[model samples]
Target: MNFLYLLVVLLPIAFGVGWWASRRAVAQRSGVQVSELSSDYFRGLNYLLNEEQDKAIEVFLRLAEYNHDTVETHLALGNLFRRRGEVDRAIRVHQHLVSRSGLSDAMKTIALLELGEDYVRAGLLDRAESLFSDLVAMKAHAPSALRHLIAIYQHERDWHKAIEHARRLEAMTGEDQAPTIAQFYCELADRSRQHGARAEAREYLQRAFACQPACVRAFMLTGQLEAEDGHHAASVDAYEAAIEADSAFLPGILPPLLASYARSHQMDRAEKFLRSLLDRYHGVSPVLALTRLYRQRDGERAAIDFLTAQLRQRPSVRGLMALIDATMDKVEGEAHENFLILRDLTTKLLEGQAMYRCSRCGFGAKAHHWQCPSCKSWSTIRPIHGVASE
Candidate 1:
């Protein structure tokens, strides 16, 4: 019945109303005033429980006007307004709270924070940036302010400011920001590389690796930079390092790494690396890669045998398709036609399959993303390992 929403959003307001009523009963000599305020509070709570937010806002605003010290109630109302996507009303409530002459510094800071968030939700980044920057400078709610500032910088694609504020947040909170900082550097590197700034891109990648030694994206960018300069051997090394950093990224790494191996005539290294992965990584990617490698180096019979052995262990639709493709030529007539049908069925089985998913939000995607599109988190979307996926 959506009572959960009432508990999360209106519970605090209800408690605050009860507390205010009790304080009034103690301080006021008039029982009539106490009964009126209590009635108003209950009426607002009833509206909230019924999911009539507009009527609830009206009753709560009246209560705020009646009791000057109901700061918590006002804050809760502003938050509810923002949650309901009524940003203008949220801004007004917070602005009124912030402008009150006798408001405490702490309460004012809280209201300002809310106002800044409302500004962000309304796409007034400049106002949000100014307010949050002022909060940081005043050392009031500095950590939260810094985080909001970083988010603003990220939205603006200002990596330098994002990194600066991330470091500041790290210093303030004593939590490691190296991994996220590395991602910011990687973003800068990707931009530089796309603009034909190879040296600048390389430098940024070095900084990314310096922050997080096992950053897979940094290793991938390193491999791309080296490969562009015709340094296939170096590119191969970087791509292999990427896999070692995170074996879950094998599907993304193996294609480019294999190309580098072939360009540098490092088939022997490719075979050795892929074979080594078979024990540590349980995904079908390494097995499929090794099967193709075997097919190229040995013969179709050897490839078929290897794929057949691996399919029993992994049992993947992709592996089955590869096996059918490899062995289709070896059969003729009815057998070949049947194999073609099997291959078509297997292909259909894999159609529209989500190859990657976000661990944070469970968002599924057909392609890989460095950040989760749903959660907006870095490095959370990973390849899904299953019978029909990587």
Candidate 2:
């Protein structure tokens, strides 16, 4: 039962016991002691109702001391401290409870878990990790501890360890974690690529595909690696596959697609892919990219005409900047000066704008994060569709 329910039931019994004892005391001596105890109880209740937490804690602590067997009181007090962000005090309380001679194994593990959480909240990650590892080793609270350990490894950027723990969590809970695990493998591939371990990077990317066949990041990485090795045709195929995997990532796909098209001299295929993108993507990136392509192939006038027409359909700050750049070369005197000032103002307007946001937690970032920093949700942060961004 909850503490409040127990208190409601036991407080009346205690009051009756006190009253009967007071009646006996009256026969033996004066009523002074009974009146003092009654007044103290009322004072404690008044402190509770007033939300005078310090005084309430003082009263509760005294009552628990007087009634030494009250495990529920101590539990309530410990939970209160934890909720108040007094994690150290909560740890001490829970530790004391765990050390008690009569505590059940279940209660002891619960206290230990609470204390481990306190360690985590206090930024004592090593201590928290060790404690949670012990819980997992003992197979008590293994699922919760494994979840926490996976989160800790993620925070530490230990993707291999995170993947191991996540696997354990899935096994213990019988829950599917392939998508998240695939992202972890992608992280491993990215790390290997950064360290120039091409073989290891390819292996991890292959593992990511095994876990999630439509993993776009894996495809993008494969395409980049293929291009770096001068396999331009394969690179073009992989980039196109990446687009097919996740068209929501159009901004990231376009630059590489354009590069691959340039490398393979496949303007026809590039135009077809870009046209398909224009139908699906509301962002201005593909529009600007196509404008550049037109200007390079045809002329400035054709690009300008295309952009001016597209701007009416989807106005964008970046499109405006592109327009100014495209038109400014032909502009002269006061008009050029005015265009320069306008460009400067537009640059200022977009200078500090966040280009991505975590859909789950609303964490704004200049660059995208696969997992939200605030909420730790996977694949939550994406490019913001805006006048200033894609």
Q: Give the TM-score of candidate 2.
A: 0.83
Q: For residues 37-120, could you state the per-residue lDDT of candidate 2 as single tens digits?
A: 555555666576667767867776776675555565677677767777888888888788878998777877887788788788
Q: Cα lDDT of model 1 overall?
A: 0.92
Clash pairs, model 2 backbone: none
Cα misplacement distance, residue 86 of candidate 2 (Å) = 3.5
lDDT of 1 by residue, 306-356 (tens): 999989988899998998899899889999999999999998999999999
For model 1, the superposed segments whose C-alpha errors exceed 4 Å read 1-19, 22-29, 43-55
Candidate 2: Cα lDDT at 57:
71
Error of 1 at 165 (Å): 0.1
What's the TM for model 1? 0.91
